[model samples]
Target: MIDAIRDYWNHRIHDLEMTDQPVGTKRFFEDLDEYRFDKLHYLPRLVDFSGFRGQRLLEVGCGIGTDLVRFAKGGARVTGVDLSQTAIDLARKNFELNGVNAEELVAGNGEALPYADASFDVVYGHGVIQYTADAPRLIQELHRVLKPGGTGLFMVYNRVSWLNALSKVMQVALEHEDAPVLTKYSIGEFRQLLAPFAETSIVPERFPVKSRLHKGWKGVAFNTMFVGTFNALPRAWVRPLGWHLMAMCRK
Candidate 1:
């Protein structure tokens, strides 16, 4: 099971080569910071890496090390793990290319982390656990590695989103296939997975992002019709329809 996903991501890394960032010409880290701000709005929330000076921070499933580089540049003692060696290697290159220092980048499973229990001040993962064979078990590992009261922030796809409906109608049910594990989490299900943590809360994130299914004006038009207008709707109205659900936990 693990090998299947690892191979999938390895092929993915080769095809995409790097994590997507906002296009601009700046110092590497500067570009990344702007990219994160525009996409994640992460200065004071969702793992709060900006406040992580001198703390031990672990990013499980740290793909290509984009966020790990940001945290390291902010002075966190950063460590990252990814199930794909292709991702791990690219992440190492990203850190070195930007002249940021991370404590380690290991290719490892989140379900059985290599570190000792209660060893980290912060554990973070984004768009990660849903793809693991056992999402609940990975949550246990997240709890295990955190110091008492340590923070864990994770994001997974929301099962009730427009994307979920569209994918089922246009991609899965239309083709007579089961939805993959990545599409498995409803808000209640994700909250239940995080229940064992000391204090856990879930919030919706990134209502529905623009799609890359096609390029140019056609893509823009599809996005405007299917997502853009709805994405701009105020959170109070769209909270329940959000495409990504963020879980914040303390262990």
Candidate 2:
């Protein structure tokens, strides 16, 4: 199962559809970064990618080192690990081309991290747990590597989200839905997965944004009708139905 997941990601880079620049080039990374921030505008506002200066930060499954680079630029001593060597290679190129440095960027399994206990000041696994073969085991490893009172930031898909319902209604598949392992968790289920943490808070985010991927009438309806309608609703009432469940954990 793990091998299948790795092989799949090795061939398919996340958000590859957003860029036409040649892979591993500076333009490619820049395009991806721009598109990512545009789509996930809430990420930097919520994650404080610049707050941990001179601190040790580890990002598990850090695809192409996008967020990792941001942390590094902000003076965090960053290391990245990914299941796909292709991702690691591209990440290294991204860092080199951007004139930043990482402590390390190795291809490794998140379920069994290759570090001593309490080794990092922060551990991050954004959009990673849902695709792992053993989500609980990966969470355990993340907690194990964090120093006392260290932080863990994670994001996963919400099964009870508006996007999920819309996808089903429109008969459109979610990105990477055909992967070897893809799981979505309800709020209660996500909380249960982070039981090892001393404290945890889950925030529902990634609300309806205009589509850059979808096309035709379905896309038009989503962009014209759904986006406006959903955002127009009282946020308090629709907050729980957000597509991404972002968790902040303390060890």
Candidate 3:
């Protein structure tokens, strides 16, 4: 299963590293002209990249070095690891192109990180671990690499999200409900899985307002009609029902 994941990413990275497919609508933030389109949310101002200044940080799956570059530029001593050699190569090229550099970048597996234990002040993995077969193992690896009291953060699709509920309702309404397995996690489930490794918790607090949810008239209509209103709600109200479940743990 792990090898299958490596093979999957080896091929997937070709498109993921080079494409801009942010969710919501095609005309939203899906600007391919900007190479960093896929990574801006994880950067400062939006997600507090500046907080990493002078910190030792590791990004477990630094695709194309987008966030890695941001961290380095933010004054972090950054190191990156990814399962795909091609991704690491592209990341190096991107860093050079952007005049950003990291302390190290290596091709590596998330479930078995290559760094020494207790080596980093912060570790972050965004939208990466679900691709691996054993997310719990990856979490353990993340915990292992962090210094005591160090922070760890990750983003995974929320299985109990409003969008998920809508997907199921849509499927049932259309009489096309088929179980397509995706590695999604509910907040409680993720917290439980990581409890032994750290003081862990998760919150559903993001919506794909840029990437088109689906590629049809119905999808377009849904986004046009409901997405804006949904986003307009207070984050405190929307946090638990959001699409992306953010897990924060301390080791």
**Total clashing pairs for each candidate:** 1, 0, 9
Q: Candidate 2 lDDT, tens digit per residue, 108-220?
A: 99999889999999999999999999999999999999999999999999999999999998899999999999999999999999999999999999999999899999999
Q: Candidate 3, which segments miss by more than 4 Å at Cα? A: 14-46, 171-181, 208-213, 232-235
**Model 1 lDDT tens row, 1-251:** 87777777765642141235532223543555555556566424666667779989999989778789879988999999999898898788788878889899999999999899999999998877877778888889988999998888888878887657776665423111222345458888888889879788888776555644346765676577866677667768878766678888888
Ranking by TM-score: 2, 1, 3
Where does the lowest 10-residue lDDT sum fall in candidate 2? 16-25
Q: Give me the runs in candidate 1 sitting further than 4 Å from their true place.
A: 14-37, 41-45, 169-183, 215-220
Q: Which pairs clash (backbone N, Cα, C closer than 3 Å) in model 3?
A: 22-210, 22-211, 23-210, 23-211, 23-212, 24-210, 24-211, 24-212, 149-251
Worst 10 residues of 3 by lDDT: 172-181
> What is the model-wide C-alpha lDDT for candidate 1?
0.75
**Candidate order (lDDT):** 2, 1, 3
Maximum-TM-score candidate = 2
- Give per-residue lDDT, candidate 2, residue 234: 99
Return whichever of 2 and 3 wins on TM-score: 2
Candidate 3 residue-wise lDDT, 1-251, digit = tens: 66666666666652342344542223221243254444234334335677879999999878767677767877888999998787787678767766777888999888888789999999999777666677789888988989999988777777778778877776523111121214777777777767855576676665546433255766776678767878787878777887677777788
